[model samples]
Target: MRKIIMLLCLLLFLTAAYSYPQSIQAYTAPLTADEQHVLEQSLSIHEIDREIARIESQQNETERSISELSEQLEGKNEQIKDIREQAGARLRAYYMGEREDLLAALLSVGSLRDFISVLDYYELIMDRDRTVLNNYKTEYADLKKTKTKLESVSAELTQIKTNLQLQRNRVAALQEQVDTTLGHSTDPEKLMAMIEELTKYWENIGLYEVRRYFRALSTAMSDFSDFLDDHKDSLVSEKGGYRLEVREEDINAFLRDKNERLQDVSFEFGQDKIIVHGSREGLRLEVEGHYTVENEPENSITFHVDRLFINGFELPDTTRKELEEDFDLGFYPKKIVPFVEATEVDIAQGTLTVKLKLSF
Candidate 1:
């Protein structure tokens, strides 16, 4: 007990001036997406199909948008024409002969009340023309803007179709190459099996990613715990626990300080789970997991994979389960054990809160 107290005192003395990250900073992800990297690394039939399907989906949506915009543009043009004609008719009526009749009617009024009524009627006619012109101006402006956007959308659809055609050409080229190399003797079933096997291989990689992410979390929590020890007074006391809350940004700060390779890595703490995403070396990966703390003999944090996505494609459930079972990325905040143990870890949006109990 005396030696344990001496160690704790020495640790506090050594870390008393340590400062936790207080300001938020962002580290930009790499420009190239992981999907592109995968394609570059292995130009397989599966990748080509995935690319084609994506472009085709975009093509269909663009066509629908163009159809809708065409209808709207037609209606707007008709509306502007009607408003312009109405306003023009009123102007022409006054210019041709109505002005003289209106002046004569005002002059012939028998009393002040009659004169006032005639003036009110003239004013009403002018206001109606003015309102019509305003409506025309507004609608005409909108019509022009819509026409411009339609042109851009049409161009986009053209590009999408062009890309689809290019993919078609690519598929033909790859198929021809394979046939030539294999003397057209390779079994069709074998080729298909190869694609399936390749996909399964990629899925296994998801487990590696899950392990890497969990390890990162472990190191981040360990660093944060060290900081917490220096400022234990700031912990909020609840009915049966003491809680420490932190933002993803601060966690990021700690990670960044630990390794320059972690520049693009970022985290999101959600309810009962965490989302990690980043791009590096022309690859992007995202993983989410629900974490639980263990305190049977030693306090440590561990998690089970809920979802894993690489380049926007989610890993299969079989792969996710494998990820959950594979590695131990548990974080043990050994320094804090002498004072308190973490009991409940909760997440909300961008914040992480760890509830603790005094370790007696």
Candidate 2:
């Protein structure tokens, strides 16, 4: 009887050890080579889009500068032309017996005062002619400099246009490659139609749901940790374990406040499932969930959590709930609600699916 009791005690201890909740961990799922390639390509496409936009913006700025320079050159040329005309008139007047003309004007004066006024007027005309000649030389020099600068600017503009064209062509080629890889047709019209169909499908299906959840999940976990740390004394239960009750709004606030944190988590989207992997506090957690669209009035979608592993250990429902409560798991769906018109959640087959009606 003593041996039997000892055996039972050992068995119970083993069971308890296996069932005990461990620390919150980050997760990673197994991926095939093809899936990995597809994910990489998708990320590359986003980067390519950014590059194309940057190049296009630079091209526009260059074109605007070129136009303004061209206008300035035109104005400079006009000024040069007017100066040249004035200089030419002054030269013709000087060569056309200017001295004889001045002498005749002095003889025609009626009095000594009129003669003195005529002499002053002759000196002013000669000085004005000299000023005009100086201005003409300056204008010619400026015109030459402006033309040189204009030529240089034109060359730069041409080079920028060529680069812009190359970027566009590269974008087109990448788009083509993406289309082919996704089994889309190379024809423009057909590709557009496919895109439309895919857009509709994405909207109606649960693609974005997984994305939003994981994003919110990461933030909620981080916030929950901080909350626990801040209120560590109060959060401690009688058993010396921590228990936290997190509402949906709390998670939503963290997610909205720190949306950029979503980039820290990795997401792998497949036709039927989404695999999310992230690390927090030295522990890795992975969640694999599948979703289906519901034809209800609310456009409800259901995501079924297929598997959840923390540090390679499968999480049971009881422990998972404990982790959720401790880590504020319910807040993830709440974070997604504001972006969508409405949201509903259903849990089945060890999975949670959130159906969302997008506002936009």
Candidate 3:
């Protein structure tokens, strides 16, 4: 009876061990030379796109500043013109002897008191005219200096814009070459591997949002899946997924989508406030608000924004409502939901952190 009981206990332990799910490790396949080249080119294209966006934003702000300065300069020119006209009129009156009435009155003065009073009044008027003329000269000189400085700044901005455009064109040409090379290949797995490699590279850079990164990944994968359907015989089953050939056009399309939607937005946490800053439609948007994350139904996490600002201008109640209606707050964890039972997003000390519970 003791031996039979011990055997039963061993059987129970074995059954329990076998019933537990085994850990699944993420697998990354090796990249061929061509695949590595494609990834490098894709990364380059993305980096260049970001650079172009930054340059364009700077250029826009510079142009706006130049416009303001030009307006001020025009006002100053008009003021100077009016001052010169007044001075010219005074000169013409003095030179043409239009002050004969003052001379005649001075000569007609019979009493010593009258003569002295008339002389003092004439001196006072002359001094006042001289002071006004000196002020006009000073103001004219200052305005000229300001105009020169503004013109110099505008010229510098123009040069910078030119250089940025040239750089963009060169990078775009290189990206085109890469796309042409990729277009000839019909292998979907190789394309998918390139995508994975590109994602890993971006992760190492450490400036991208995981959610946005995954969305891009999903888009690339979906595109590739369609391509695979067209050429099913060449499709290779891989661990994560197959790589879709990323073209320069694809990168441009992705950038356009990102720009249309708000890109480069990041949140920083403080003692009791969260600060958000980024550009939207070439204008800077900032927000200082209380941040909260709530778990919604169907494994969604909603990040709530209590307040928002665009270009330092606070949105009105109606505009805020419109913003809330247009922008999505719920981030769906597509790739992470499989491995994570629960997910939480938190902000602390200027960093946004994500906490995950593993299903294991």
Among the numbered candidates, top TM-score falls to 1
Query: Which 10 residues in a row give candidate 1 its minimum summed lDDT?
Result: 19-28
Clashes of 2: 15
* Candidate order by decreasing TM-score: 1, 3, 2
Off by over 4 Å in 1: 1-43, 181-195, 203-253, 256-360
Tell me how many clashing residue pairs each candidate has.
0, 15, 3
In model 2, where do residues sit more than 4 Å from their true spots? 1-33, 95-119, 184-360
Q: Candidate 3: which pairs clash?
A: 191-243, 192-242, 192-243
Ten-residue region with minimum lDDT total, candidate 3: 20-29
Better candidate number, 2 or 3, judged by TM-score? 3
Give the alpha carbon lDDT tens digit for every residue of 246-271 in model 3: 23233334434444342355445665
TM value for model 3: 0.43
lDDT of 3: 0.55
lDDT of each candidate versus the true structure = 0.65, 0.53, 0.55
lDDT of 2 by residue, 18-100 (tens): 33222111111353443334333443444455556766777788778778878888998888888989999888877898767
For model 2, give the 10-residue run with minimal summed lDDT: 19-28
